[model samples]
Target: MVMSLLLALPLAVGLWLVTGGRALAVVLARRITAATAGATLLLAVATVAFGAAVDRAWLPELGVRWSFGVDGISSPLVLLTAGIGVLVALHAWVEVPPGGSPATFLGCLLVVEAGALATFAARDAVLFLVAFEVVLVPMWVLVARYGDAHDPRARTGAAQRFVLYTAVGSTTLLVGILLLVATAGTADLRRLADQAGAGLGSGTQLAVALLLVLGLAVKVPVFPLHTWLPPAHTTAPTAGSVLLAAVLLKMGTYGLVRLPVSVVPDGFARLAPALAVAGAVGIVWGGLVCLVERDLKRLVAYSSVAHMGFVVLALASGSDTGLQAALYANIAHGVISALLFVVVGGLKQRWGSVDLAVRRPALRETSPRLGFVLLLGLAASLGLPGLAGFWGELLAVYSAWTPAGDRPRVVFVACAVVAAVGAALAAAYALRVAGLVWAGDRPDPEAPRTPDTTGVERWVIAVLAAAVVALGILPMLLLSTTADAVARIGGAR
Candidate 1:
């Protein structure tokens, strides 16, 4: 019952929001989305609290099931998805994308939520893949349709890139899944996890792992394959950016860990060294790019490349500590990134543009709320200790320095050093962005004073701020939940 409600309820709400008589109405859409998302949030909380895995066979003949469950690793992400769904719905209620009916925008948002919920809950390989694909369309719609209207063509182009890149990843992912099923003789993730690569040969495992990773990597946007992310984030609506950063990106990293690293141990071991190196490059590249970027949202988008690099490093490290850090970092990035986008979006909403040079003084003096939230986001994002963001990077680097699996020490250590440098660059850019927004004289003193955050916006910022601090102060809250599961998956060093 709980598993069913967690996925079905939000999807049902999305359906009604898109098709009901009042589907076109903003207030109705908000009411319905809020009510349903709120319920889903509770269900997610319950799932985490129980920490039980549930599997109900749905396609017995095809070796699939309507399996849905949460462990220490997945529970936190499921919770993050649900909480953000409510926040996104609430935030959208007031800040509907320009030139669209409130119903359509909010409805698509709900659908994204439903897809994300299902993705996080999936326990079988086939189910995970299906839920994974479910999220693409609505997200594409958000990017292509309700994107930055000023550059319609750019938005359309970004949407195309997103679709093309992700589509290729999906094709590769399907092949990987089929390969795993053929080699392992089942698509059941639980069974595979138990097998621990016993039945598959090293060659078969490597081939399957490469294909699966190729699919998930494009989604994770690992370095060379990450070109699609910035443009998509830049063009997407605020809700789209939030969801993309917060939940959608996690799907890729999560899948990589849950699928390849967990099920194909020998294959993952083969890829670990190179994977760590790629992650290192992404970390450095993302940070360096952020330093030069002038567009606030795009800078944040690139920062994701750097940040998720930590998660990638952690997974490649293949130690309990590294996996734990990756999980922690994944959730922390989701919260911090969403907060950054909200503040950036708010700035754009008011200033008509987020050209840091043009909208310098308005944010801090005109609206201290934005200023304050921006500062918090910057501090948390720069891997400040006692904040949620610190643990993931710190542990990932440590794990890399002293990797658990039998990978090359030189490679992991070199990558670890590079990631640490990336962390410093991250600080440089985070502070730099905050300084641009909060410091300096008014570039446009007479450009009309933009209004500050509203009551709802203030509340939203406060809640997210509290979450960042809470996780930072009590990092164990997440670490405790994920430690056992990650240890179980990789056997901590």
Candidate 2:
């Protein structure tokens, strides 16, 4: 409980600084940011040390307790969020100029990190909802205030759309939770699981499942509900984009696994086919859009939709193998997407544009190092074997071929094949970006040439890139950790 509250302290401090007096705010802001970062880092370490420790009934009345813990299911994600928080802090140390109160941005980031960690660690539905929603306000401010000012409309519009889409999803999720509590007579997940099937009617169970999934789908931003993602990614500052892709979006899928599947297994099994269809559609649709996207950031953003679609497909398969694959894919997507966003953010910072065509010809000649890094990131994104992307794709397809008894194996197999096609499309777009930007003509006289990656940027990217390669080569490290949790969730042997 102390560790959790410490994790949340930075954000609280940040909020104070943000709302404080303008005259001395800048000085106070710097102090606040330093304090927050220090405290956050310590708490993050404590969380790892306390690994999987649960404290139930810390608050009995609200049914909200310090029922927090880490597992193979959540530990990796918690580490990812904390690790990224540190890196983003490092990045801000150099990038953010002096005038703007760094306190607010850092505070918001810490808050987002706290929320994300809490979401992953939460064992209770109400606690999860609180942690999940806590992320929204800070992130919205980050985009609307700290993002690119050159296009204020784009920034504000993207933030608004993001809020609207996610809010609707959250409302649905709240209703689903209420229904579950009302029908099942308790909100405790373990208790719900024990009592759900026997107590609730099939129709009621299915309805609750659908409602919860609908809420999660929007956060997963699957296909039609995904409109808010690209614009948000395109307009958000680099750190904001990193957090959004790497941690925030996973909240949806995490909820799906933690809530519905854990508490209402039969309901999820029944809905697997429709879920598979949605995943298939998102894979195809997002891939097609990426192939045509001219903006580098937006292309990467759309690619996330495609990548996450694979995760959804795996989950929808309702097999132990599929669940494991989805877990692998989820973590892989986080690392790869963070790499892509970092590369794109670097490009935008250097060249003043994310337009692939405008920045193309000069990339090889001027920014060779950054270009090479971008290529590596894109290769990982394309699911090249021995990179982080391959395991998930391979496992997802494999699971589709051998689905659980309850699933529609034929449909899942077809979706797997379409996903394969999407993979090929990914390769095409990745190669196109590489060729157009780093392999083609000499320097474009019209476009400005920029410096190669700086020491700090190179160090940050190298860490992320190395992570991608390591995960790709040693997927077993992740697989072993996640397998038990995935099996437990699926009620498999």
Can you write out model 2's per-residue Cα lDDT over 1-493, one digit (the tens) per residue? Answer: 6555645576566566556623445455555565666666677667766763566686577565667777777877877787777667666644552224566676777778878988888877787888889999989988888878789899889999999998999999999988887887666665675554557788988988998999989998787789999999998889899999999988888888888777777887788888888888888888888888999899999999999989988888878888889888999999899988888888787768878666345566778888888888899989999999999988987887778887877898888888888888889888888887777543467765678887767878888999999999999989998887776665632
Candidate 2 RMSD to the correct structure: 2.4
C-alpha RMSD between model 1 and the true structure: 1.6
Task: Give the per-residue lDDT digits (tens) of candidate 1, residues 1-493.
Answer: 7778888888877766666734356777678778888898998887777754577778888888888888777888899999999899889755888746677677788888888878887888999999999888888889998999888999999999999999999999999998898778888887888787887888998998899888999988788899999999999999899999999999999998888888888898889888999999999999999998988889999999999999999889878888888889999999999999998898888767777656445467778877888888988888999988898899999999999648889999999999999999999998788777776444567667657888778777888899999999999888987877877886521
Name the lDDT value of residue 149 in candidate 1: 86
lDDT for model 2 comes to 0.80
TM-score of each: 0.97, 0.93
> What residue runs in model 2 are displaced by over 4 Å at the alpha carbon?
21-42, 52-62, 97-100, 193-196, 441-446
Candidate 2's TM-score reads 0.93
What C-alpha lDDT do the candidate models reach, one value each?
Answer: 0.86, 0.80
